[model samples]
Target: MEVKRVRALAQRALIRRWAEDLGSPSAGLATVEAIRSHLSRWVERRHGTFSFRLTQVLTGHGCLGRYLHRIARREMTSSCHECGAPSDTALHTLIEFSAWGPQRHSLAAFVGGDLSLPSVINAMIDSERCWKEMVLFCENVMTQKEAAERERENSTADPLRRRGPGRRRLRYGHLLLPP
Candidate 1:
């Protein structure tokens, strides 16, 4: 029957033989064309595209390699000033860190309380999850420092502002009746 013929053709041994023949250096033009056509069809069906943030973090700003080096603890030009841990890699820093554990936990909570690092990265790279958390991990240290500076400036300036003529002050003896 036709079913039996199809089953026999689909057998592993037959498929291996066909693959070997096609992969052989002496494969014919027809075999090469068939392989190319199959690959094209597979690509079309998959519809794959590169993740944007992944590309940026990995290559755009040199963060990926720097992070990797830090994690590995190999002699690097610089290390994370906050934790003093030799920043190994971006993945390791994000996933495995004693100091950053709390921040990572917070981020995981934001993303439905799942702390899987790969999942977090996938979400970040796809731009569908809280990727800002990752950005904060790298850049928000400066933000915190700036905030502290602003607070210090405001505290120092408060007394001066209170004493300036622009601020109206009422003396206890200056009470007057409404006209």
Candidate 2:
């Protein structure tokens, strides 16, 4: 019941309509207020490494994706080159990447064994999981991502690869025509 109310309150406008939802600060507030309310009510604000990293996952802002594309137009492809997956969203990386199966499974079990993104977020502070474990998970995900980026950079930087046609592949995958 409370979970349903929390989800509903997170919707901004519906927050007020759910008059019985007066317990949560987001029950009848603006969108920004609702966000701030949730942060103020549920999340800790002080300096904590795990919470800082977790917030990036919660807000859908960390790692490679559309946001990374925006930040580094040339460095990142909108789609994942390694997996040939479309969008390559943060959610996809966290919940769908095949290579992350083991980490995901362990993290999912730690959270609630559901493996759903929403469940994972809701379980952020659940008694079943510890914050340090979540932090380690986030750290591992980031380490893997960083290593992939470095590998890609090293591959693209090598200049000795021979091309079949009269074209060349640059660091950003752009083709160079023969002189």
Candidate 3:
């Protein structure tokens, strides 16, 4: 079925479910109806027909009903590991992470620095410039993680690597003798 039709049907079903849960007018059916109408209007105002599914996936909501609840709560936050900054909000994390200054500089160098989050998101969704940069960023992070893991492994396996080869012996890369 078309997505809009599906969404409308889902909304209708949700309103019905809410109404059923209320059981009778004594249970405040009018309030439930008002809420449903408000939500439908909100969906229309925000162009939810085009983005409801994507927003659900990105925001960790698996269904339209859950996504609507999450949006209503405005629940978004993550703590920045680098600076202990609260990077919970979408805009803050995307545009204002303390560690993001350098990362954004790097990204801008590769993709144009002045780009905004919405533009970047659009680019990523459209498989444009920001998409390429996102891939590069992931690669760089993976490479750094791999390097750190190798260093950790090497350090644990051979402490002499932390010291000079003079303390041990030249294995493959360099030639150094103990002084």
Candidate 4:
């Protein structure tokens, strides 16, 4: 049993080391670096959990659309549903999407528009208003993107509809009437 435990621990350590080594060399990997910077300071919090759970999204890459899609295998492409940009990355959602321009401006003003991950994290730690604005901006973008995806799905003719129109979809835990 002791030998088995030692073997398991050794394998885990090896896998971790290999993963870290392969973590880099991708094109346009600044977003990953920025996320790392935020996480590096996670333990030494300059402020308490300000905006609450939303801050977790800001600190990790896995919360981004690309990672989520990749994990779920929902679609072949990880492109932004709004703009069709490649791999709706965290940086792209936060910095590049023109759809959120107005909200970005508001959040940017609070955080001084640095747009760096550490800066945003620091701003959240430093001010509750900044934390709130950041959370609102991120949440707004996600909500808009999800709404757009729903619109796309609804617009596309369901193959079953060709069989005839007695189709219903569940919305808000209730059945939606057919058009």
Candidate 5:
């Protein structure tokens, strides 16, 4: 087979594998599911500069309390620290958290009504202004959340309760070396 054709076949297979993974109920990729709804192909490119805060809001993989609780038990509860919601997931933080009411209202205006992840994403894709508005909202909320997290860590008197900035994971009872 030609090299170009071979590469195309490989790419298709990879995309198919990713789609299967994303669809699996066991995969637990709720945020990725939101992005998948907007994609034309399994691996379409989005136009825009990437920002950490925006990615966190879209992916639910960052400093969000639910994610933090799940990943490393860094948080005592998955509830929103600001509003005490059941889960501090990305959707909750962006759309439901009362603390971000002002910013959410601003973003909703650009999104054209009540905000859903898909609506936020659609608005972002349709207009650069909307994209900026969403990013700004994510930054504003995430920054405050992060600052509060840091303050909590610093104020705690227990040394064991304080978290280190570096990440460490145990692998078979041994610490994995940081890359």
Candidate 6:
């Protein structure tokens, strides 16, 4: 009984720490709401194979212009590169981007018009083909977006300021070591 109590307490502490971390503004991930909504439980089986593209699409942390502009400061605006949507969020790219109209329409047709995240998730779980479709959609969209972003950066006034993946641009304040 004592061991069980201690284990339960430890689990509670871990969950509390995770919640606090997720709430932090500098958590580096912008999909807190999505993570909380879709992936909070540990026991649930994930439907699709994991990939970087899928992670980017689901977490809103990749080359999407909104993420680039707001979180990474890599873009001047959060507009979609193709359609110029005011904010190029993951959902916007997935569901509404005119550039991806054919793919989106195909996906929507497959899922019967319910393009919400929950519906997509359920579709993926319900069919392997749906999972593959989702993966393909993410790959197609993210690859094009990444290429466009690279081209934009290279054409910009200061391409040298662009940091590669896993590298953070250091500010003057970040140059100092903590005492």
State the C-alpha lDDT per candidate: 0.45, 0.56, 0.44, 0.63, 0.76, 0.74
Once superposed on the true structure, which residue ranges of model 1 sit more than 4 Å away at CA?
Answer: 1-87, 115-117, 125-129, 141-179
Positional deviation of 152 in candidate 1, in angstroms?
A: 27
Clashes of each: 10, 0, 3, 0, 0, 0
Tens digits of lDDT, candidate 1, 146-177: 35435544666444212233223355334556
Ranking by lDDT: 5, 6, 4, 2, 1, 3
The C-alpha TM-scores of every prediction are 0.32, 0.56, 0.30, 0.57, 0.75, 0.68
The TM-score obtained by model 2 is: 0.56
Q: Report the poorest 10 consecutive residues by lDDT, candidate 6.
A: 34-43
Model 6: residue 110 alpha-carbon error in angstroms = 2.3
lDDT of 6 by residue, 59-173 (tens): 7889887888888887778887788789988889887877888888878877768877777876776677887888888888889888887787777787442865444534354
Which stretches of candidate 5 lie above 4 Å from their native place?
A: 1-21, 25-28, 41-46, 165-179
- lDDT by residue (1-179, candidate 4, tens digit) is 99999987886676566447547836435534554444434434555453432543454333355754665344456777667888787778778888778988998999997977768867876677887788887677666665665565567675421222322433332555456
lDDT, candidate 2, 1-179, per-residue tens = 99988876676455444433544543213323334434432343233344554555544455565445654444345676558787766677677878878888888777767655545544553442434556667778767876776676567743422122332344534544557
lDDT of 3 at 105: 68
**Models ranked on TM-score:** 5, 6, 4, 2, 1, 3
- lDDT of candidate model 5 versus the reference: 0.76
Candidate 6 wrong stretches, greater than 4 Å: 1-43, 159-161, 164-179
Runs in model 2 with CA error above 4 Å?
1-41, 44-48, 51-56, 157-179
Clash count, candidate 5: 0
- Location of the lowest summed lDDT over 10 successive residues in candidate 1: 160-169
What overall lDDT, based on C-alpha atoms, would model 3 receive against the true structure?
0.44
Between candidates 1 and 3, the one scoring higher on TM-score is: 1
Better of 1 and 5 by TM-score: 5
